[model samples]
Target: MPTIPSPRHAARRSLFQSGIGLRLALAALLSALVWLTIAWALAT
Candidate 1:
């Protein structure tokens, strides 16, 4: 009989494989938005 992986284990593996790219993209987008907001505040 083959052993099956738990749902938690499979989810964790998929997150490790694909989550970093998503996290990095989100960080970059957030930083850009913050920078633009600061610049706009200073200008006005």
Candidate 2:
């Protein structure tokens, strides 16, 4: 027998699928912040 998914799981899957661009932007933003912080530390 096949198991059915719960509502919470379905909602989470949809949210994750919808946030592809948001995830990428967030990743890029975080990467830039880390790079800037490292550069500042090295410059000081």
lDDT of 1 by residue, 7-44 (tens): 77888889997888899999999999999999999999
For model 2, residues 1-44, the per-residue Cα lDDT tens digits are 23356777888888998798789999999999999999999999
TM-score of each: 0.61, 0.59
Candidate 2: residue pairs that collide = none
TM-score between model 2 and native: 0.59
- In model 1, the worst 10-residue window by lDDT is 1-10
Query: Which pairs clash in the backbone of model 1?
Result: none
lDDT of each: 0.89, 0.88
Question: Clashes per prediction?
Answer: 0, 0
